[model samples]
Target: MNGIEEEDPIVFEISVVVPRRNLKLENEGFDCVEVLVNEFRNVGFFVDRVLGLHDEFIKLAAPLETLGVVAARLHMKKTTHIGVDLPFEWEEIEAFMRQPDGSLFSWCERFQCYRHLIHFFLIEKNSDVTLKFDGIEIQWEPGEALLQRLELEGIVKQVFPLHDETKRNKLLRSWALNWWDLISQPIDEIYVYYGTKIAVYFAFLGMYTRWMIFPAAFGLILHFVDFGSLKLLVFPAFFISIVLWAVLFFQFWKRKNSALSARWHLNFSVGTSHGYKLSGREWNCLQAPVELVKGSGIDKTKEKEDLQRYEWFGYLRRFRNDVIVILSIICLQLPFELDYAHLYEVIESDIMKFGLTAVYLLVIQYFTKIGGVRSLFYAVIYWWVFYHALLHRNLMILRQVLIQRLIFYEKQEKARGRFDWKDTICYQGGEKST
Candidate 1:
């Protein structure tokens, strides 16, 4: 209890749901639940079972030592500035260092370690072992993981990560619910709690929002303040200023992203990060690397071919998905867009135009819904559409709509591209992981 209390920061909860009736067995040689609990305990997980009405819950937590051992074996990349990643030598544990914040690993890394250990626990083939849970004989196969088998058999209902209440409350008070600090966020604390992906996302969002103020102010001045006959000069000046601001903003953002990655100890350029991911997958209960090598021997040529095949397969899949999306837009959305544009041009009545515009907005929203998206793209589009229809009354309103739509689409495209770039390391080889 003392050890568990001390390691609350890194503790994760895993819920195992079993039917209330099946939770207890009368004439059981070896109960499935008991065996499962024993296996988890054997692998260094702290397990606690709680009885409920319909299903029982088993919560799990890992000690710091267990996490360190797995992390060492996985060869997770450490910050080059701090230290290189090396195999965990338990005897020489003192030589290993904690992160700058004094924590050994981030929440994200710890969870991965937990997943690997649970998913990869091997079963020795001794006999035809069947565990009875209320007369249900669930078959346990030799040379396979018990958890995976149970999961497939519907015995283990679901395995998902749980939040630490203590840490979550701390974040809620200091970060989420705190409005006193609008621009600044506790980024390191966020990274520690939520992991790299979420923390990086917030960091990017904060920077982007802050950078937008300059353009927002410039646009306000252009709209409200009159330059009279110097309108041409003002337009060009505003345009150039915006372009420069965008260029500089992105440049600074790149620097910021790189610094964050280095600080977080993640390598972006090389396959080390990629290797780390693949290693995590490989370390799963599917099979050991040694076993794989022994079973097939080293096939460097085949491995090369396989890598190339996977790479090409990924490209083809992406290209195909893009084509489908493009075709869909051309076939479904383009016609509506064209029809709306033509109607807006020919129709004279501002009232009819307003009604038509509102209908068009609804149609676009319908299309977005059909596509199963309520994304930033549609949100921005909706804002612009409503702004033009309600507030903007001018001779060049239609032209403005077209221009704004084009600009919005371009911005959406760039945003998506940036998102993909950021996500590449995390999700590039997603198919292979599972």
Candidate 2:
């Protein structure tokens, strides 16, 4: 026997044990063992059996030091241990395990060791056990090790970076100037993209105005005729008027204003450097600058003043022009609707109306030359009247109808039930009393 020697590999069954009385292990619902086994597998450990013990001391003693040795060797990663039964102090377990320089690997190793000790303690207390991390057992406990590991995770060093306000403002200014340039291009260019929308708006306004005038005149006629049946006509006319009003209101409030604001903001944000290039047609048709047109010999001061004046006048002219359109539409529609003479007496009434509108348009073009405060005021009044009378009126009518409907429904319901009149009404000697 002394002449020969036999050699075999050392086989050790690494058992992670937890105690039955360990509340953290119990509250974790046997999943802690699985978690531990999986963690071991992650770090290249081959787990044998996850066991639970009835005695805490036996559970704590079994392979408690061995787990630390395995963790040190394997270099495990740190993970948060959170459960109902975990002590509040264990919240910083990771932080407690962290190295002075806040390295994560050190914390992970320490956390793993703590986890192993808990596993051992839990298995000793409880018979129930789960296999995790290559079929290794896990347990739960409380200690400074977990907290140290948590701090090492650097969760408290949260930060948020924000843009500098001054830089942001400068960018916004550039964007706004660019947007203004984009929108203030020639009508021909605007027509290319938004012509259909504008045409639709115009068509809707024309139809809406006709509907509005028809009802107002019809209502006046009915009022003069003093016919009870004509009162029904008033209701329909009023309803139609209300609907037209809503359409106009929606155009101005919800559609047009919103569109303008969105366009403005878009242009401003994108800056002029990126704006669309002018077409050949636009370049050819472009008017000379007011300074050049005035023949004010390129003196810097005079040029600046002329440009400022031109800008002011341009705004005034545009306002007056829009007002003229509004006035023409109103004037033409009102007279036609009134019809003081035979409705079809004139063969060219429609043509004449159109001609008169054209004349007004020509007049507006001429007055654009004599720009002043008067033009500005006229424009403001024209827009305000048209917007409020036609657009806002329709909005109000819709609101009234909705409110009335609700009121009507409530009254109908109340009339149907939910009230007792027995005590208030009485009949005596065939005579009814309220």
Candidate 3:
């Protein structure tokens, strides 16, 4: 090859001025300029020039210096064409250049010209400058000849209106409506679920403890005391318990299904319209006819009113009813279990047992109201006393043994663990490194 072709490399330079106040708020110190520069580089712009200014100059004169120093340092090692401009009066220029920290001026040998009148000069230019600010156009030739003519205009003018009172008020109203919708809707739905579940469970347990446990225990004690063949009562007692449990279970199941369906409708209505697709479990659980009611078409105000009505009737009132029924049964069975001969004698004598019953009921009620594990212990104790009087044999003990077996069997099956040699190899690096 007689001649090898060589092409001039493309050189690009950009300058950005940041106000000193803005820099102080952002960086807190001059040393943080490097961090700012790296952030700009990450956005793909190659900064080949920088200029730093004193705080007073940026506030009262040009604010370009705050951003300039950061820009130059970023390109300092990569290109010889990199430069920085410092704003100094002509009188101080020589003395400032001579300072030990003033080595930044050595790069200024490439300065094209100085334009003093406009407070801006062309230190170096590989190309012309073109910029637009607030609809005003700016163009500079590829030299410093007209640099002094470019006016040092004050802060840029606004092209758009600063305040739109109508828009602001509309945004605030919309935000308030959305926030109310979020709080009221979700809370109502959660309360409905909890209330229905608790009510059903309480009702079932009450019937079981009252009709089955209390009667059977008392019948057993009578057989032992009288030495008569009263074992025949055991079959009738068992039959009644089963019947009570079945009826209660059916009622609980019905209410539980209704509550679950309502919850599904609530979830589907709120989430689907907002572009969220339900997960597989959510989709399966909420796939009910009630959810087909379009949430978008439903008025939130009307829905809220309807939900409040349902919450009062279907949840709060129903739960209170169930609580009253359960506690009434518990109170009625306590004396039968305690074998209070005086109370039994009063009932047998045709005198009302109300006074003694009420007094003992209040005592039991007070003890039950004490919270925590203590309350649970007292409940179990009452259950035992009632069931023993009704059945003679310890039904509570039998029930507890059955429950423990079921729970422990499941736990034992799930407790099996797996070991893999691959896991040991994967973590082997930890042993070596340490």
Candidate 4:
């Protein structure tokens, strides 16, 4: 909420004032109340039109919208910010997460609150809302009735600054327990058990943290240790272990993703209303009709094939552009390399080697995002895997892994004929899906 106090609450059609005066913090009510109201309206609009699902169903799609909002804030614009107080009782949060009769409405309502928090932090200037890490640092801080509650119950253990080694072995129930309980339920029925995607997302994060941290430990060990002549035994063994662990982790994920999809009924089949047809959502026009073109002498099958070919060729074109872009970059840098090597005898700075390389790779990634640069996007990924991996550039590696997952899932959908070429690119953006 954009907190501002004023006698005339209505500044714009989308901004409303909520009056609040607590403790010494006497001021205006939030201004952006209407903005979030509109955001939910937008969510409703998509659910009603595109998702073709009900309100309870909106709980599931809302996470996707929330994620899409975060993506937009990250990539496109940071125009809106809102915050809502979340005061969840530990027992209630647990009961909602665990009990058969828990209210999903309450749980999802909290998630929407969290989503607003995400939007607030998306604006770089407003990122100070969190107490770093597990929220333990502020556990002893006195609570105030006026400000938003930062306490998150059930997700974290009772965090205190001083560690009691004596109680190290003592077990405490965790917020993670809530997610685990959801996971332990029949995967298919998890939807009925908990209508919140945060549980699944957190569960995946737990698994991913373990998987990623284990490899990083090995990397750190390699960093600190001097293997000397026995290096032969160390490097190869670490590499093989990482690769083996990665394969096992991903294989497990493949099954997990499949199980969830199946439970959610996303298996695409003709006339199937449930599976790969969650909302029967297509990349289609929701606005003006796309008028059919007058026929040429082309056969229908040939026309379809041509359409598909042209659609997928964007990848090929992207690759070509990536090559051209990289060549141009190298051509510009060739003079510097030569000068560093001979002419001016200037040694290449570390900034040029690592920092500038990251910038170039980022440019490639950005280009890939801009509709015409898919090939360069992929090229950047491949280069990261090869060279960045060699340098142990974990950040770039992480980005590539996430991007590849999206690409992989997209390809899977395409392969299953979730939508034909006509429904893919030819569809309208429709109200901008804004």
Best by lDDT: 1
Better of 1 and 2 by lDDT: 1
- lDDT of every predicted structure (CA atoms): 0.69, 0.38, 0.37, 0.38
Sort all candidates by TM-score, best to worst: 1, 4, 2, 3
Candidate 3 residue lDDT tens string, 199-247: 3455445444555655567657765665445434444444444434444
- Quote model 1's TM-score: 0.62
Maximum-TM-score candidate: 1
List candidate 4 stretches off by more than 4 Å: 1-200, 223-226, 263-434
Off by over 4 Å in 3: 1-294, 314-318, 321-333, 336-434
Summed backbone clashes in each candidate are: 1, 49, 12, 11
User: Comparing candidate 2 with candidate 4, which one achieves the higher TM-score?
Assistant: 4
RMSD of 1: 15.3
Per-residue lDDT of model 1, residues 128-198, tens digit only:
68887776788777778888887887778878777778878988998989999889988888888878889
Residue range 16-84, candidate 4, lDDT tens digits: 112221222122122122222344454422222112232111111233234334333333211111222
CA RMSD of all predictions: 15.3, 31.2, 29.8, 24.5
Q: Model 1, residue 397: what's the lDDT? A: 81
* Candidate 2, superposed: residue stretches over 4 Å from native: 1-243, 246-267, 270-298, 301-305, 308-312, 315-434
Ten-residue stretch with the least lDDT total in model 1? 271-280
